[model samples]
Target: MSDAWQHWAGFMADLAAVLLSLTAAALIPILSVRALRYLTARRNDHQRETLHRIASEAAALAEAAFADGNGPRKLSLAIGYAQEQCAGTGITASADTIRAAIEKAVMDYNAMVKPWSGLPAPGAIAKPKGESYSQ
Candidate 1:
């Protein structure tokens, strides 16, 4: 009959409309997640490269300071230089951290060099030369 056919057509139209709306809604979240992931990955790459550069420069400064003698004045200068280089470059470095790294490196170098200087040579016996401090 005509009434039954009309009812069937109305039901199918309603079902199609519901399916289309859901597909559109689901697309928004999928696109947003993809965009967010892309942005986060870019930021991480930049930070990693910057950190590597800061660490290398810090090591150079520490080595130079060690060669100049591990005195307070030299340490202070090294700290200041590192702070200037790494302060606002969007990295996680700080002056105190760099200073600590420099101190550790100096200590390690000193330990490595001590044995060589303290040990006597095969051809000569080691002893104090003279009272250089005598008045």
Candidate 2:
């Protein structure tokens, strides 16, 4: 009876060990995949924020450095500066994407600083010049 009990106990221990090993094997890959996904999302977010910052700064610099009516020159300066900055920071952005970002930044800046000059304010009426509000 004693020998039989010992054999049963050994079998149970071996079973538990195998189960633990299997659980760890199953969980490792799942955990690894989740970790990888999380890291990728964080990296992408960081890159996007960095690109936007660079675009905004480049746009402002171009606007300040160039005069009005030099649209093409200003765009060229902003794009070149943004591309150079991106390269210096190890970012890989195409010229079109950089241009789009810079344009967006400039639009946003303009909207903030000169709200009436661009698009009309939301829900505002467009009246002819010299027309009174009460008319």
Candidate 3:
């Protein structure tokens, strides 16, 4: 009876080991895939943040450099500047994406800086002497 009990205990131990091994094997791939997806999502988020920052900078620069009446020129300049900056940083973005980012940035900037009157003309904010909005 003692010997039989010892044999049964050994079998149970071996079975537990096998089960643990199988569980680890099955979980490794799943854990790895989840880790990879999390890392990819983080990278994409960082890239998007970088793109938006670059777009905002480009829009501000264009606004400062170009006159208010030169809407087309400002758009072109901002797009070119954003594309150049993105390329320098190894970011790949479409023209439409950059344009949209710039537009959003401009809207945000205007909303923050421009006074909310009853009705104001678009792009008609006058800056005081030595007072810049970009600062």
For candidate 2, which ten residues in a row score worst on lDDT? 118-127
Assess the local accuracy of residue 115 in candidate 3 as a C-alpha lDDT between 0 and 100.
50
Top candidate when judged by TM-score against the true structure = 2
TM-scores for candidates 1 onward, in order: 0.43, 0.80, 0.77
**Which of 2 and 3 is ahead in TM-score?**
2
lDDT of 3 by residue, 81-122 (tens): 999999999888999999999999999988888757546676
In model 1, which runs have C-alpha deviations exceeding 4 angstroms?
Answer: 1-21, 68-83, 92-135
TM-score of candidate 3 versus the correct structure, residues matched by position: 0.77
Query: How many pairs of residues in model 1 come into backbone collision?
Result: 0
Q: Which pairs clash in the backbone of model 2?
A: none
Instruction: Report lDDT per candidate.
Output: 0.68, 0.92, 0.92
Q: Write out the backbone clash pairs for model 1.
A: none
